[model samples]
Every structure is written in structure tokens, then in C-alpha cells.
Target: MKKQSTTAALPGKKTVTAIYIFVLAYTVVQLFWWGILLHQQSKEIAYYEQLELTHRVHLLREPSEFMREMQRHHHEQRMRTLKYIGEGTIFLIIILAGASIVYRAVWKQMRLQQQQQNFMMAVTHELKSPIAIAKLNLETLRKHKLDEEKEKKLLDATIRETNRLDQLCNNILLASQFEHQNSQPFFEPLDLSQALGNALQELRDRIQSHDILADIEPGIGMEADKFMITLMLNNLVENAVKYAPKGTKIEVSLKTEQNDLLMRVCDEGNGIPQEERSKIFMKFYRIGNENTRKSKGSGLGLYLTRKIVEQHGGTIAVRDNLPKGTCFEIKWQDYSLQPV
Candidate 1:
């Protein structure tokens, strides 16, 4: 069903209204200026008439003459004022027309964004149930071994595919959450170091298989919502593992910088193209030209990380690391590191 909404005025409408009011008020100001000029001319004529030009008989004829001249000037000014008012109205109309175009465009963009978010959420929910069941079934199948080596290989492949599905589902969930303005993140303060440590422990198998190195600086602490922070690092670590060259090191650094807690994840992977850096934070945005996203991830990690940071009044960004790599820097304003 096509939803019909009696949508209230958005910021765009209010801005257009403001422009119209400003233009109309400017037209009134043009009339007002003419009136002021006419009055000033009358006053100047009165000063000159009784003193310098005429009426030694105390100004009867001179005042009438001055009034007539003032009337004539006022008539001329009225014509100019009317012309200005007409021009002002036309300009205002053009501005209003332009504003309406921009407003409609913006409104359409917002609606499309909302629709996409809904679609991602619905799809994620639809897939999650089956993916979980498949994972469970695969695990169950591992119990009965036909041939030891063959069973192990099949189990590993199944697990890999399951991880891929989970990653996709996670991306969808992140997109859905980001789309909601009133999303209340589940927040609980935790040690920043311990959280990273836990995440690394969980990815142990991937690390061992890929021989990925964790260049972690020891003993950093901070105040943060545990689950969100964990998710943040999980995305970064996963991104690093996915993109970094084989046998390359992923550096995870946690420290306090200028009264803000910072987590800098540097991967010796292909750096984001300079043009695409701004857009990589957008949902569903994938790096093009690289075409090397072989590992499974929903492509929403950085975007979710950004939303979570904003929720906690923090910031996250990506930049080129010196000597050919990408670095993700997360800064938390109200965070602190724990004692060594």
C-alpha cells in the first residue's frame, strides 16, 4: 500500500517561508523609504522659503508652493516605489520557486533514505532466522564424521559461510539502527583495554589461520558503553583483517589525547581512495575500484561506528596512515584511560 501522510512542514518549508517574508518586508521598506524622503524634502523647503527665498509676509504662499513641489516629487517617487515593489515581488516569487524545488528534492531524498532503511531492516530479520538455523545444522553435522579430514574441511567451510551470513545480518541491523532518530543505545561503562582484549580473544581462530599480528599497545582504560565500543572495535579489527595484505600487522592503539580517549586502528591495507573517504561513512557504501572485499562484512561497520560515537558525543574517522595504509581514529570526549 502506498502510504499517504499529511506531513507537517519540515525545516525546508520554514526556510522558504522566511525567505518570502524577508522579500515582502523589503518591498514595504521601499515604500517606507520614499515616505521618509518626501517628509525630509518638505522640511527642507519650509526652512528655505520663510528665510531665504520668499514670504516676508510670514509664509502663506511659500508654504503652499513648497507643499505643491513636495506633492510632485512624491508622485514621481511613488512611481519608482511601485516599480521597485513590482520587482521585489517578482524576485520573491523566483526565490520561492527555487526554494520549493530544493525543498521537494530534499524531501524526496529523505523519503528514499527512510525506505532503504526499512528494506534493510526487514531483509535482515528475514535472513537471520534461516542463517542461525543453517549454522546450527552445520555444527550438528560435524558430530558424525564420515572421514576425519573430509568432515573437518566441510565443517570449516560451513563455519566460514555462516560467518559471512552473520556479517551481512549485522550490517543490516546497523543500518536500521542508524536510520532511527530515537535509537536508545544500550550503554554500560567498561574498561577500554579489557574490551579490546576480549574482542581479540574471540577472533583467535581467524588470527591463527591468517597469521594476523595484533600490534596492541598495553594497558589503556577509558569510560565507554561496553557493547557499543566492542562493536566499534570488532568492525575495525574485522575491516583490518579483511583488507590488510596477508602476513601484515594490524596496529591497535588506545591512549588519552588532549583529554579525550582515542583508539587508533591502523591497518597496512589498501588505503581508501581520497575521493571515496568522505562517502565510506555512508551506509551500503563500498570502496569501488579496489574490488577486494573478499571477506564477509555488511559494509556498515564504519557507519555504525560513527553513529555510536555520536551517541556518546565522540567522533570516528579514517585517514591515510604514513607509508601506505588506512587508520581509523576514534575520539571520545568524556572518556579517560585507566591506570597502568
Candidate 2:
């Protein structure tokens, strides 16, 4: 189904702030009226005093004082009704303000998710041409004669880039589904080491050309959607390779960090700038640092990567790597779905 545009679904932050301000002003006006009119809710001693004074002035009967007191009670009741009306009005204003804020925030998020889906579709299209080119190159090589080792190397390159493109396409699709709450994971007890290794193998040429170095640990395992694991690893590794400078080593280390399955990919590039760090996972977030931007990206890779991770009950974060560069770490819980 076609999705609604995000621009129409979300109220801008300025609008939310304006509504808040108006609510506050209305509350102030209500309180001001309260102060001017019936400030005290307590029974007024002055009412009784005025009644007694009039009684003494006219030597009035006891029944007249009682009647005057009754009139004072009626007056206070009417004033209270006005105050209650003001209070109710103020309460309605407060409630509407809260409801509008909630509606705007949630509506904006849903629209953003739809836009992300659109971007994913675009990314899938971008990936196709490169993959077809790689495939054609590989197939054409089989038709020609070449030294076995060199041909093997070229074949490897084609395969690696093709796999990278494939992984990226799959990530976009999976992320789109997950973001829309449509991904139903086929979970089973699986090996993390193998899944991560598969992604690394596909990226070997990219890693070698970029001089990225990896450290792999065996026996790290998690129960997750196998496809999602590969997609997640692909994003982390690709992102590291893309940002790190030429000849700098990129490390992929996996082990159980406490109760979570921890996989870390670190790059020895110029590193992410501090200011733009918080927005790195946003759908269109890109670094302001000129060095990283030099490398091309769809800007949705990490965003999609994180979505897949979240689907499997995992967390991903980026941090500065020691003195320089950046490191991304993912932690996944080990939980199994019981067979039905």
C-alpha cells in the first residue's frame, strides 16, 4: 500500500512548543480571574460580621440575621460555581495540549518509518546495477583465458562486491519490513561466529584493499534470525570499511560480553566527529567530517542495520576508538523460541 507523506503527518516542533505556550497562558488567565474574584474558598467571617453589624444598626430580629446569612451562603456558592467552571476549562486545555503533543510525536514517527521504507526501495534500486555489472564481469571472465591465480583473484573480487551489494539490498528489505512491524523472524539456535565469518568473507576484497584487519573469536553464538545476523554484520563491516582511511586496519571481534553476544567492528579512520555522533543512526544522518563524507553511502545502511538488530532484541552503538577512529558494537541476547 502507498504510504502517507511524513511532512503532512507530523507537527513540527515549533508547533508543539506554541501549543504549550498557549496552554500556559490560558492557565495564567484562569488563575488571575480566581485571584480577582473569589480568592478564598473558606467560609467568610466578614459575611457574619456584616450581618451582625446591620442587626445592631436596626435592632433587627434574629430571623433577619439568619436570612442575611442564608443570602451570603448563596453568594459564595455562585462564586464557587464560576471558579469551578474556570478550573474545568483550564483542565480541558491542559488535556488537549498533552493529547496533541502525543499525537504529533507518534504520527511523526510513523511517517518517518514510511519515508525510510521509500528510501529502502531506492537503495534496492541503487544496488541492482552494481550487482549486475559484477555478475556480467564474472561470467565474461569464464569465457576468456587467463592465468588461474589472477583469474581467481578477479573472480573473488566480483563475488565479494556482488555479495556486498546483495547484503545491502537484503538489509534494506529486512529493515523496511521490520520497521513496518511485518518481519516474522525464524529463530533458531545458531552460531554467531559462522554468520559473521560469512559476511566477512564477502567483504574480504574490500577489507584487503582498504587494509582492514580483523580479529575473530570462535564459539560466540546467539539465537536470532540468521538472515538478520548477516545483514547486521554486513552493515557494521561495510560502514567500518567505508569510513576508515586507506591502509588502516579494521577489526571485527566477537565474543560474549557479559550476558550478551558482543560483536565489535573498529576502524582506524579519522573517526566520527563528536557533534554529529548522536544523529549517526538517523535515516539520513551523514558525518560533517569531510573525510568520511568523501566515501559514498546511501546514509541508510547504519539505520537499517540498527533496525535489524533491534528486531532481534539487540543494541548497537558507536564510540570513538581510543585516540582515533570509530568502533561499533552490537550486543544480542541469547534466547530461544520453544517449539510449538
Candidate 3:
């Protein structure tokens, strides 16, 4: 029903925009047409006045007076014509400017609405897939007496699906909180190296298909919220995992250079297009069409990651990873490490 309503509204929006453009075009055409008519009318009036003056001068027998009157009339007519053109041009410029602004605003709103609709579709799939998998695994276990190893495998798969579902819920909730400014980071002394290491270890254990590599420098500390940092790390690594092909390398690195702290996650997979780099962090913005894309995500991971990074007074950006794939780089400049 929601999709149907959205589909129906799109045509209406397009129709409204079409009508608006048509009206604006008509108005502009009419404005120029009227200016032309007025110019011709002014010329006709001047011509008649000139003839009348010539007849009067002939009767009075004063050629000098006739020439002076003709000059004055011509000057006044020129000034009136210029004034009309100037006023019409100004009005046309104002109308065009207004139309451009309105068009841009409408386009932006439509794009946002489309993104939101894609997000809804993605979220529905994301929510249902894990629940279905977990349910199937449970049902399999309930129906048959499975061997120990088989049972363990089934249990692990179920656990992973549940974890995925839990993380999805967390992302949705955190995104909402951050958007509304209801959640703020609670900064305290934290073991940055240990936190990163632990997060990477968890990822390695849960995701067996990918090779997760950590090049973290030891004994680095900072003032940040531990929960938020862990969440951010999970989102970044998970994003790489989602996009990168199976068995590809995912490199997570953390180090300090002078007073600046840096973290990077580089993946060996198909890289993001340069055009999409700027928009990847926008909420509900994914790379491809939601219906056709094979990847599974709600488009909130990077958005939440950026928000968490900014909340901790840091910056994040994406760049091409050397030969192939993409790299997400984060930096905290002039960061002072707290004593562990």
C-alpha cells in the first residue's frame, strides 16, 4: 500500500512540475510579445505626432521650431522605449531566478523521497532475511536429531543471523538518536588499541569468509566513549565485509603520527565510483537501486559511522584503495592521549 501510494504520488508531482514550467514559459513569451506590441505602438504614435508637427510648421512657416519639436519628441519616445524594455527585462530576470530556485528545491525533495523509499525497501529485506534464516535453522534442529558437528554449525549460523538482526536494530536506533540530538558521547579515558583489537577479533571470529587484518599500534589511548567507538569500528569493518567479495582482504589499521591519530579500513573489492564518494555518508543513501542490488543493507552504517566520528571531534573520508576497492580514512588531529 505504501509503495502504491508513492508510485501514484510521483506522477502527480511530475504533472505539477510540468504545469508550472508550461505556465512560466507562457508568461515569459507573453511578456516579450507585449513589449514588442508596445514598441510598435509607440513608434506609430511618434510617427503621427511628427506628421502633425510638420503640418503645423508648414502653416506657421518656422522650420527651426519644427526641427526642435521633432528632436524632443524622438528623445522622449526613445526614453519611454528604454524604460519599458528595462522594466520587462528586470521582471523576466526575477521570474527566471524564482523558477530556477523552485525547480532545484523540487528536484532535491524528490531525490530525498526516492532515497527514503529505497531505504524502506532495504530495511524490510534486511529485517526479514535474518529472522527467516534463524527460524529455519531452529526448525531444522527441532525436527531432526542432528550430529554434534552439524548441530554446532547450525547453531553458529543461527547465532550469526541473530547478531546481524541485533546490529541492524542498533543501527536504526542510534541513527534516530543522533539525528534528534538525543544521544551524546560520554568521553572518558579509553584504551584505543585494545578496543580496536577486540573489535577486530570479534569480526574475525564471526566472519569466516573474509581475511581480517589488523595493523594496530599498541598502547594508544584516547578520551572517547567506548561503546560508540566499538560501534563505529563494527560498522566500518562490516561495511567492508558487505561490499567486498568473499575471501577478500579487509585491512584495519590504527596509528598515531605526531599529535594526530589515524584509523583506516581498506578493502580489496570493487571500488566505489568517484561521483558517489561524497554521498555515501548521507542517511538512507545507498550506491545502487534497492530493487536490483544484491547487497544487503539498510544504508545506515556509514551514516552512523560518520555521526559517531564527528561526535568524537574527528573527521572521516573515503579514498580509492591503491589498485582496487575503497579505503575509509579517519583522523583526529592534535589529539592528546589519556593515561591508561
Candidate of highest TM-score: 3
lDDT of 2 at 21: 68
**lDDT (10s digit) by residue, model 2, range 197-257:** 7767766745675655556667555667887777777777778877777777788887655
Candidate 2 structure, TM-score to reference: 0.61
User: Cα lDDT of model 1 overall?
Assistant: 0.66
Q: Write the per-residue lDDT of candidate 1 for residues 1-340, one digit (tens) a residue.
A: 1122213324655786688678667766765676567656755655664354334434546677776766665676566656656766776677667767876796667655654544454455446755776677576676665677766766676675576566556666666767876566765555567678777776665454334445455676545577677777777877788778877777777776667777788988778888888987776555531123344344577788788778778788888888989999977776555664
Q: Model 3, 1-340: lDDT tens per residue?
A: 6557667877988898899889999999999998999899989988898888777876766778777888899998999899889999999999999999988998888888888888888899998998999999999999999999999999999998898888889999999998889997789989999999998898887999899999998888988899899989999998998899999999999988899999999999899998999999999999887756888888999999999999888999998998999999999999766556
RMSD of model 3 against the true structure: 2.9
Q: Which sequence of candidate numbers ranks them by TM-score, best first?
A: 3, 2, 1
Global lDDT scores for all candidate models = 0.66, 0.69, 0.90
Clashing pairs in 3: none
TM-score of every model versus the real structure: 0.59, 0.61, 0.89
**Regions of model 1 farther than 4 Å from truth:** 1-81, 84-145, 207-211, 217-219, 241-247, 257-259, 289-297, 333-335
In model 1, which range of ten residues has the least summed lDDT? 1-10
